[model samples]
Target: MRFLLIEDNRELALATRDRLTLDGHVVDHAADLATAQDYARTMSYDLVLLDIMLPDGDGRDFLAYLRDIRSDTPVIAVTARSEVSDKVGILDLGADDYISKPFDFAELEARCRAVLRRRAGTSSNTQRIGDVAFNRLGGTLTIENRIIELRNRELRLFELLADNPNVIFSKPKLVDRLFSFDEDVSENAIEVYVGRLRKHLAASNVSISTIRGLGYRLDIG
Candidate 1:
């Protein structure tokens, strides 16, 4: 998964980033609201771990702006404020979840995964497509009883494609879904990844089909 960590506390931000990176997630850090807004505008992230108390602006306002841009990107408020009203306000304003400050990094990671799963229309940690099965928590893919190892990005790519088999996704859309601000990638990069995934799926009779000008789609039927 890819994430943007918006926290003014330098120490917490570094620790959070390190933990997330070690867990196979690509993370981008922003020390203030200005940097966070700029990164949000220019790049895509799977989830945003936002600190409500920022130097320049309120994180709630940032959440509002993100919604204004018609971005349904999931956000989790990581703040010290634990009041019921505060949590209610952010959640009502479209924040997917909340994590109190001085919290466990493991819990944050778990929340991030949960939020993404909800957004992706997945009911739980495990997802299956035809004969292919994926365990989100385990980060393992299996086809017809055979285990298939995939990298973080590859796993995410498969999830996106398999979620709605036969639905085409454009290159830009795939890039947005699979990459974070830290990954310097292009549309062509998606093609390369798709090529590799196609080869891996060749033996299983799973196909990632290109729909000409439309995009790529996973054809299970």
Candidate 2:
């Protein structure tokens, strides 16, 4: 999944972006209102992590713009205000979820997944690839009741492939989907993660196959 995080707090934004990437999401970060608005208005994203307070304008104002454009993309508001009315007001303005400042990254990830699953109309929390079970809600992968020891990036790659079995994903698309906007990634980097994941799932019925012109796909028997 891909996300746009519009946050002014530099340290917080960096940390949040890093965590989202580690969880297998591509994140684009904008420090202020202008950049955030431009990206939200012009680009397609699975979700937006928007901070209500901004240097150039209020995040709610941007929300109004988003609604005007008729974009159904989910927005999760991040703000310092914890007032119930404040959260309700944002939700009424089309925000999908609200989290106050100083939140745990795990909570943010859960919100993102919840919103995505709702939008996709999927009620299940677990996805199976052959014998490997991916717990999307809990962020764990297990094979035959035993957890697979996969590093962060590799686990993310496997999740992506397993989530969309038999769909060929190009290298560039995989790179964009797997890495943060600020991260330096290449096609070779994608290959590295794919190789690691292939090894991790070697004993399972899941296999990663390379397409002649396309890219890679998850083949489960």
Candidate 3:
């Protein structure tokens, strides 16, 4: 999973980012609302760890902007103990949950898992395409009990396409979702990932099909 942590306290932000990274999530940190906004504009995150007291603006305004823009990505407010009063309004404004300051990092991890499970509408982390099964949480692919080894970027590309199996994603969209702001990725990088994933799925009933000039789709038999 990918996450954006919007926090002003340097120590706390580093701690949180390191912890989430250890747990296999890619995290981007911003110390102020302006920086957070810039990060948000360029990339997509599966979840957001937001601090209500940003240096430049209130976090609620960020929440409202996301809602106004119809971003269904889940937001979890990380607030100080005194900000408990703001929870009701925050939730109403589209926060998935809130974690008070001085929280256990373990608790935050569990909350993230729970909310993401709900978002996926399943307690299970498995997604199937014909006989091939992808364990999204574990980041593993299986077919009839056999495991397939794919490179990290190939796995990410496969996961992105699997997430929206019905939709055709252009190479530009793949570049945005598979790589981050600091990475220099070209459209050719997308093709390489797709080509690799195709070989991995060659024996399976599922296929990653190129739609002429339209880009790619996950075709399930």
Q: Each model's TM-score, in the order given?
A: 0.84, 0.78, 0.83
Best model per TM-score? 1
Model 1 Cα shift for residue 12 (angstroms)? 1.7
Where model 2 places Cα greater than 4 Å from the true spot, the runs are: 18-26, 41-44, 64-72, 102-106, 116-125, 136-140
Candidate 2 lDDT, tens digit per residue, 184-207? 878999888888877777788888
Candidate 3 residue lDDT tens string, 135-213:
7657678976789865667766776677677799899877766655677878998888788888888888999888988
When sorted by lDDT, best at the front, the candidate numbers are 1, 3, 2
- Candidate 1 lDDT tens digits, 184-207: 898998898898788777766678
Instruction: Give per-residue lDDT, candidate 2, residue 39.
Output: 80
lDDT minimum window of 10 residues, candidate 2? 148-157
Provide backbone clash counts, one per model: 0, 0, 0
Residue 117 miss distance in model 1 (angstroms): 1.0
Candidates in order have lDDT scores of: 0.83, 0.82, 0.82
The residue pairs in collision within model 3 are: none
